[model samples]
Target: MARSTILIADNSCMIRKGLRSILQNLENSEVIQLIDNKEDVCGIVHKRKPDILIINPDMLPGDCLDVKRELFNENKLSLILLSNRKNLKNDLKADGYINYMDGQNTILDMMQEILNKNNKSSFPNKNSETISSREKNILKHIALGLTNKEIADQLFISIHTVVTHRKNITQKLGIKSVSGLTVYAILHNLISMDEVK
Candidate 1:
């Protein structure tokens, strides 16, 4: 069982302390950092590369999309929106959300789900054989969110060859989704998160 590293970013001291206290009780979870301002969130996140980041959407700097893109490009982590409203903003791309009014059980359950998903995506198939270097190039492109045609053109290979390599990569890793492959690539150091689009 892998431990999940968590970072809480909120302007409110009480909110940060409360979340940290509640999160500490979760099994195999650690509250690694408590951030009080938005400015430090991205910098710390890039440095620590926590497994989960629970933050208020308002804490994000300037344009949310740009900040999110930069943060995710550097670190593979789950983002959880922390808000007081029951109806969360639909625009934010987050794994989960925790309301200020939510009970301890609700928070625990949400965090657990994020942790489970992270663990599943982050770990690779142990019994699988080694991937060929050519297949690895394709996997890196796939993890970087490149289309088959793009990968084929970039590698000077046919689209059919790219597809075949993708199939082989999936078979070897037992990971079907692009997101899963991205996580695997990051974990294996096949591609850095900074390279992800």
Candidate 2:
């Protein structure tokens, strides 16, 4: 099996240290670099050509979508944008997003899901289907063990709509049980594992 190269770009030393500590546990993971600038991201990515690139959304130049497109046009490199704000979730342009607050195990699972894949093309792309913000909100509630009626009330939607959204989320992500969806939510940064019940 080939070893994985991961590049982490964050302005905070603490954040970089935390992620490196978690990611280093993966067997055969190698050549990890913690960078502190947005301008250097493209240069490093071009030079190192890491298998996976983890970066803070705030550290990216201009709109993240544009930066993702320009810097990650190669399908072999998977990009993950990390953020703590719920509202920062954008359309599924990058491979995915990770909440910086996730537990160590959840972070490991998310990265392994990308790295252990047989082919890089299996990673999420611009054309891949994504869960809507409303669906993501409902998913968070469901993961917290809320009833469909309770979720509907909380989101100001009908119970039937809540069911429909759940079904859509299931179909898009191919995850059925509440636990599976909870893991999915954590992996996608729709909700942190700490927020799950």
Candidate 3:
């Protein structure tokens, strides 16, 4: 079985080394590298393409936000932010974030969580955002396995309108895949499985 790789990025080599040691000890995880140069992050990621990158948000060089985008957008790397502060009351949209604490935030827990996530993808939807009437209609139509064109015709709209509605629905619901949307639609009684099939 292939082991999962974690790439660590921080300004301090000491911090990186410590994290590297902990992560390498975690079951089913291998440390790809523990490096400090922020400039190296994007290049290394493009080359090695580790499954996840553990990066210190404060120690970033240049535009870390852009780096996050480039890594995720261009290189397709998942990011896990390492923060030293507690009580992150505000919403920050990273794949995950960890404060450098001792207790059950152990390397073992991190590894298990990541691997579990790999096998069974989970989306944390705490908000349960209310869908607009139009998005809900689009989802219902999709659940019925109607083509966008069919939905447009049924709803007396253009195919582009149906497509636009779908985009809005997924965004509002934070659902990225068809199966996720379908399951949600069924759970909400928007449509039946038989209808989709």
Candidate 4:
């Protein structure tokens, strides 16, 4: 198993230290960087290219959409949002979110889940095929509990096209049930847990 590298970015020293402590228990994982300022995040992420990034969007300037695009587009890494806000903005694309008040066990479990998913994706099945970006979009919508018609309407595509994409997704992933596909979407970071219905 490859070593999983994680970067923590938060303005709070206590939160950073606490998250570091909790992450220390993860097997074959390393906390590569602890960033306290938004100014240095992009540069560090570009250089280090950690496998996972645990960051607070508030630490970044503006809406952080530019940072998200730069980091995510450049690297295939998991982005976990660290926030205590009751209502998180939907614009921030994150693989997961950890509340400040969450217990250590819950945090650990979330990390472990991300690690497990990372591992699985790192080495996929030999016969397993990849899905296209369009299919992924449809799969994400499906996982979000959208009906076929809803997905078609949202994507501005015909219902027949949506159905075809869903069929292709099912065949490629070998997952027929919606629940199974939802799990796949969540694990693959296509959609966060909060987004799933």
lDDT (0 to 1) per candidate: 0.85, 0.78, 0.73, 0.88
Candidate 3: Cα lDDT at 80: 78
Candidate 2 displacement at residue 145 in angstroms: 64
List, in order, the clash count of every candidate structure: 0, 0, 0, 0
Supply the TM-score for candidate 3: 0.52
lDDT of 2 by residue, 1-197 (tens): 35788899999899888888878788757646888987898888888888888888777766645566776677478788887867555543667678877888888888878776623554344224888787888888888889999988888889999989888788888889989988887887877778876
Q: What is the lDDT of residue 123 in candidate 2?
A: 38
Off-target runs (Cα >4 Å) in candidate 3 are 59-67, 87-91, 104-107, 121-197
Write the residue-wise lDDT of candidate 3 on 162-196 in tens digits: 88888778877888777788899999988876777
Best by lDDT: 4
lDDT (10s digit) by residue, model 4, range 3-79: 99999999999999989989888898999889998899888988999999999988765675545666568698888
The residue pairs that clash in candidate 4, if any, are none
- Pairs in clash, predicted candidate 1: none
RMSD of 2: 17.7
C-alpha lDDT of candidate 1 relative to the true structure: 0.85
